[model samples]
Target: MDNNLTDRSFWKAFWESRIGLIFNIKRDYIFGDMLGKIKAKKGYQTAIELGGFPGYYTIYLKKYENMDTTLFDYFVHQGLVNELLEVNGLKETDIDIIEADLFSYQPETQYDMVLSFGLIEHFKDTKAIIATHLPFLKDNGTLFITLPNFKSINGWVQRKFDLENYNKHYIESMNPALLASYCKELGLKDVESYYHGKFSMWLENKGTQSALAKAFVKSLWFTGKVFTKIFPFESKALSPYIVLKATK
Candidate 1:
């Protein structure tokens, strides 16, 4: 882990850049909603975020919710940890840092929420990937999962523009429905799915694209927003990402 990544100077620079803007949008739209639901529920005590590198979402949740938080990742990015703590006005003791792989790791106790983002899609066995986390959740605990939906128009655009890490995704057909089915198979009740992230937000984070490509994306921003506003239902269906909320 690069210390520079968490250093206040580097964070300040990135926070002022377009990538930071994208991150803020993602956090607000994704984490904000999910954490709101978590806090709304009864008996919400602790949350454990798997694959929480840099823990941006975890940090945000910690700021609002009065619960014990834990971050589990195979590799520890100390810079991200420090940056999150400092930015969120949290201390080292405020959150637990665990260095462990999900496959072989088991918790001594369960949490009120077991969360993971952009994780299960990387493995061939998505079922087992999710099942592995079951033991870490308390009875009636919520399991939240978010992944890139490669079946939408946003997916086609990302592919056409070569803006995604295709090789990193084990399957091309990942969607909320498929994930919901997995939860059902595992006997998880009250499953729900949502689509989020329009083209403009996706393009904003694609900071490495060519100048002409960026200009093309910029042109579509207003049109996309207008289309989404007029056809909100359709827009959600064509959104770039999927989030699954289920009870264990």
Candidate 2:
């Protein structure tokens, strides 16, 4: 993900659409996983979502739990926010919405948790992105990030059998160890990272794909789903997503 390409407008459209290869939903498993992490730590009163578009994750956090939430993203996608509010039968009083480029915006107050999913991987400087958010989190706050694990077995399967599904925006695939090192260098404490999501998820969330791609995902959908049910365990090194969290 090149910086030049990650302009506000592109992301605005990306949130509204599922036309491109990279426009993937933050799948249910990943959201649930994040919620579990937040609950485990037990201090989720105030939270902000960086690059939160369509604002589903923020909505989920607010709806299921008690939290003061803010969603930051480009202004062009404000309509999507409104739509989400209406669809969820929520009101503006529920959460604050800020429309601005993620890098330029500054928070007036720090939060208990700062979250971003499929965000840092798009940039060349992952550390810089994380660093920018540090000032916005309260002391002992949690920083949570999730990225597509392109180094995993599911990644290999996509590249081999579904090239269109593998896009260039994934400039790099990061592991838990790599994420831990970054957090350490940045002075973040209690760092933890690992894999999430089974192949079955990839099969079900093939959004707006071409006929050929749809057929391909469908062909193996049953097998993948069954495999997960039988195994009932996610492989740390082979899952589809890498989840990272640390405290500041």
Candidate 3:
């Protein structure tokens, strides 16, 4: 049985309201910088992002790294993806978009880089979900995975303000060390995992927030943004994400 916590309808509705919004925070820049550094070393030619619907991060790979990019997702919002691509001065033809389930789809060729941003944590079996990406990676190819650090201060805030969204993620898969260990056990080389990004208090609740709750969350987000600007730091207890990088 498929034990994925989220479904197509959930994502469809989620993207309905966010079709045109491209909110780039400091963490996004940090992640792009990380990608830039990796690109500098390997000069990857091709890349794919599993479960990448609107293809946000993959845009960075396409634009900055000059990679032939593909976004594979179970349910892709093609119109939204096109809109985002247009905003970045890229055409829909620039990215090859394949709409298919991650579990059932098979590619004819592997890629130099395989990525999944905030995808694996939705499934109950962390290792099984992660294993799905390996077959699509070429030998010596890089595998990058990132998930929200829901055991930290961000998790506490989400539980307080956005419990519905918090419950959707399998918190057991949110540990960097555990993720790195899983990569090694799966026979990946040079596996490295660590906490990523500075403090962030953003929540992704589907429900409407009370005025007081909204104010509090806004205040927290503002404070976090300021702190990110002044004293940028990443720690297991405060960072909002866990990143895993490995080679096949």
Which prediction has the highest lDDT against the true structure? 3
Model 3 quality (TM-score): 0.91
Candidate 3: where are CA atoms >4 Å away? 19-30, 222-232
Clashes of each: 0, 0, 0
Better of 1 and 3 by lDDT: 3
Which lDDT values do the candidates have, in the order given? 0.70, 0.70, 0.84
Question: Over the stretch 1-248, how does candidate 2's per-residue lDDT look in tens digits?
Answer: 24533666556455556443222233363466557567666756888888777676777677666578888865436655666666666776798888776676777889888888877776767677778778888998888888877776566656765564455345454667877788899999999888777654363135546788777666666667777888766675446777888989
Measured against the true structure, the TM-scores of the candidates, in listed sequence, are 0.81, 0.82, 0.91
User: Deviation in angstroms for 158 in model 2?
Assistant: 4.8
State the lDDT of candidate 3 residue by residue for 1-248, as single tens digits: 28999998988887786633554323355578877777779877999999987887778788777889999998887777877887777888998988988787778879999999889999999999899999899999999988999898888898888888888899999888889889999999999999987887676652477888888878877887887789888987779899999999
Q: Residue 163, candidate 1: how far off, in angstroms?
A: 5.9
Clashes of 1: 0
